[model samples]
Target: MAGKFEISRRSNGEFQFNLKAGNGQVILTSEGYSARSSCENGIESVRRNSADDARFQRKTSSNGKHYFTLTATNGQVIGSSEMYADASGRDNGIRSVQDNAPAAAITDLTAA
Candidate 1:
């Protein structure tokens, strides 16, 4: 789970994780941050990336919004979300990206 982005409970029953994106968007979060870290990870996941690669990438949407993608190897149809922005809209969009990354991770395998 070193390269994988996730929030797991430590033996002490605390949340610990490396909040990150392939590009360098990362943070240090705690138990209360599980939801938030998950959100960040979700955004990183939905930014249109490869399943085999552990690093996450940031992508853009048709509306010119920066976002991310999460891909899984099961060949399923996961959902998508947007990346953060300087404005509230961007933050909201990125929030969606976080919420949808896990779902998006289940999408079909992209072409090599």
Candidate 2:
């Protein structure tokens, strides 16, 4: 299976998305957007920014977990990743986003 973007509604009624790898692992996730269109735009931002290494912000939490945020050209955080146990794992997550986001198909799971 190819990587895919899974769009869904949050419990608070906001829209969010997850970028999953071909093996069905979620490499990246989006912030909640008040509108579905904004959520979709976030996906586009991920696609556009994933290819640029500089667009990814790699950071370590105070608790020592590692994560990454995909930033748009305008400096907005378009997407983020789940915490990883190590920096290498976080780096791998960034690479997964870079490799999969460009061609991932959308799988809309939101209610019609």
Candidate 3:
């Protein structure tokens, strides 16, 4: 199965999206946007930026958990990964986003 982008509305009335891998694991999550269109644009940005390794910024949380953020060319963060127990897991998440995002289908859960 191919990966997919799932867009949904937040409780605060904003919009966000998740990039799910083929196995349905969420590889990356976007920041909340004030509008659905902005959220959609974020998704497109992920698809465009995921192709570049340098766009992925790997980091360690203050507590030492590993994670990564995907950034656009303008240096804006497009999405981030969930905290992982180790750098290897965080790296795998980045790889998953790169391998899956470009061709991922979009599923708009916000549809009424």
Best by TM-score: 3
lDDT of 3 by residue, 1-112 (tens): 9999999989998999999999999999999999989999999999999999999999999999999999999999999999999999999999999999999999999998
Instruction: Give the residue spans of candidate 2 off by over 4 A.
Output: none
- lDDT, each prediction: 0.39, 0.93, 0.96
TM values, all candidates: 0.25, 0.96, 0.98
Model 1: weakest 10-residue lDDT segment is 103-112
Candidate 1 achieves a global lDDT of: 0.39
Please give, for residues 1-112, the per-residue lDDT of candidate 2 as tens digits.
Answer: 7899999999999999999999999999899999989999999989988999999999999999999999999998888899999999999999989899999999999967
On residues 1-112, what C-alpha lDDT tens digit does candidate 1 reach at each position?
Answer: 1122444555654444433333334322223224544544443533443333333234666666665433434433223333445345544444543533334322111112
Candidate 3 clashes between residue pairs 3 or more apart in a chain or in different chains: none
Q: What are the RMSD figures for all models against the true structure?
A: 13.0, 0.9, 0.6
lDDT of 2 at 83: 97
